[model samples]
Target: MGERANKRSFTQSGRGGRGQGGGAHRGRGGAKGASPARTSALEAVRILRERDAFAQDVMEKTVDVARLSPEDRAFATRLVLGVVSTRGVLDEVLNRCMRTPHDVTPDVRDALQISAYEILFLDKSPHAAVDQGVELVRGIAPRAGGVANAVLRKVAASKASFPFGNPAADAAAYARLHGFPAWLAARLVSDLGAQDAHELIKASNEPAPLYAAVCAAKATPEVEDEVVADLEAACAAPEPVEVDGARVAGCYRLAGGRALLDGRVKRHIANGCLLVSDAASQAVASLVLPADRPASFLEVGAGRGTKTILIQSNAQRRYGAQVDGYVTIDNHGFKTSLLADRASDYGVHLEEALTGDAARLGEAVGDRAFDVVFIDAPCSGLGTLRRHPEIRWRLRPDVVTDHARLGLSLLESAAAHVAPGGMLAYATCTVLPEENAHVVASFLKGAHGEGFELVPVRGQAAFATRVTSGGTDGHFCAIMRRKAL
Candidate 1:
């Protein structure tokens, strides 16, 4: 049992700057002992390193059950995300300090990574961070304490000397310092240009802004900030601000709060019609319904049903009675049930919750049937680094090609369901051209080209570029009109 601490506070403090150590000390338990929340966060990081789990998924699952104090929960969340964000550089530091180097276990690696991450990224004292890290290891993996302590201490001592070179020119150096797979590094540098690519990599290593959409059904634009503030307050957010509207409308940014889970936050999210979404997700959904006109729509890949809710909310607001029915589909039965449940709550008559693959979903619908088909294709989700920091280290460049192919398959299949004179949209949260424009481009090169025309994304101001500014999540959306056959 770790000591429990009073609620800690976080501040907006600006975008901590590029490649700078923006880490800070999260106070340990104040009275009884260090809270279990702190330990749970540490343990989650360890599990990630030891078990090769995705940090975001691991943290999401762990935080739900950790029974952490609000402050402790926030601390733990930050520690886990920070360590993952800087894992490449942290790994390099650890490798240099190891005696046998290769002898470290996953648990030990996880512990050491947390410590080194704090030393390098946060404002915590190296000695205190290292000591706490060693203690974390002792409780979880007593046998590996000695090795963990030695390696972490060495990391603390040599924190000033880590080297992360340009991945384009030096792939090995890039991988070691940035913690990205070699292929991803090469692709980023190639597509984004060297400087922009490096900046993207650096930005991915930072915390992303947490956002919430005020359910327009319950709130208006004037009250969006109030809703955002109330939710942030309920979550004990260190920093919360209203950034932008969601894909449907009425979205606000809860800058520093955890996206999901937290005793205080769980209540806040459930209380209102707020949907937690990044700006990119909002923007893509917006593109699908850019006007105040009703159209029959089908959403492919409506996992857990968040997007379905966003779409209905948007359509009802913009088109009112003019909006037609929404038919959502996914391969998983559970997801279909989940979507059905959520849609029922929103008072939306989901045309149907069908079970089918995205690529083949068109077969389920008659020819030239849907006015719009939104294929929010699944990909690496690299653009969501701030929220899912651990992904960078675990994501391999090879996955991009596979995802691109899958995305294309889904797009091609989706096009068939799109009625003549209707629109087919392809989108992903990934920034890679391969999974984005390139994939769409390649798909267009095939026979699909004859039937569809690319429709440019309508609102650029609402969109964020992959370089310079750190506004929205990475997303690529291409709308195509189905040619009258």
Candidate 2:
């Protein structure tokens, strides 16, 4: 056996596995087959470093190249996401374990981080993971093999604890340990208060459960539950159980949505009339269901028409025969084609699925035409952190802060299309004040000069208080009436 013992097990987790201190140990020859499996993870990390690809993207691409078995692909993807999520914590550990911390290159650091994640968080044998990491380096960057082997071995042998001690006492420590940027941590702390911020961060780190909204035409909550249970049992990753039936679609939330589940879900999704939707997203669309009778409605920034479907469902039920027209707009023509497909299913006659920038919607649709215009503006998408974890790494502080200007310009464009007594609902999935309240406030200040006045409508108290109280996404909707201009 190697001097460094195997203390973890990648095959099984939770109990009776490695890290019990007395679990069964694999012999020296046991690691031979495992090195190639670990190389999948190394390839993922290398792509992440070289191309700035997301861990999941890299994992998917590498799996195709390596032709990993389904089981190995799942395991490798897990390790990649785990390492990326804990990069800061692992770096702290590597610094303590290395002879000289600053000497480690980014590529080497990524490899070391992969090893550390398996050793610390995953139930993998530290010795095997470390050794495999060294082999991975030799395969990728042959020149660094000796140094990689030595550094990884030193890290695996360390009994020293993490350097940024006591996450409870230090918010930065918690952020670093959990793989979030410092500014994001501070912003969450300020927005959600300390205790809630901590809890939210914890939730954001884990993989989000896949959910489906059951279309009422196909399945009920009872039927959806059985489908979810069957899917969960079929795969290790669980799908969401039917907790509550949706008002529009008979969709059930599932626990998992790994790419493998797509083929499985497709049958149920088509037959059951269910569509994949995040719970948060479904909530946002439900905020305003316009009165059904012969009303002209506009959905601005209708990216892929997810919310448009929600709106149409509401219209289909409430109006039945009263819907005069549905107009959806987006800057991209590709998304408009998608919208047209979805519109066909619901018998919605899309008056105009215009392809123009949101900041110029006023020119596309003449003055004061729409009864309701939903401005689902482009945003940082911070509120959806759980599903889009890569955004944390991709977003810059200025990107969010400067978004208010873009949002304001778009709002200005859309305001002209709101009829005399129409509603303008401005919403974003981000939690930033600049993107939410501040943008709304600035837009209202100028729009007021043109006979627009913010109306204190019922059901808007939650947004008025910045609480998102009605199970809504982080949103801002200001209903304004133009005074016979």
| Model 2 lowest lDDT segment of ten | 1-10
Once superposed on the true structure, which residue ranges of model 2 sit more than 4 Å away at CA? Answer: 1-37, 50-71, 88-109, 154-159, 216-249, 258-264, 268-272, 321-324, 338-349, 448-460, 463-485
What is the per-residue lDDT of model 1 for residues 134-187, given as tens digits with 9 covering 90 to 100?
766666566777887787877777766544455356776675565565667777
lDDT of 2 by residue, 54-96 (tens): 5545654674456555456556666766666666567777787
Per candidate, the number of residue pairs that clash is 13, 18
How high is each candidate's TM-score? 0.80, 0.76
Measured by TM-score, the strongest candidate is 1
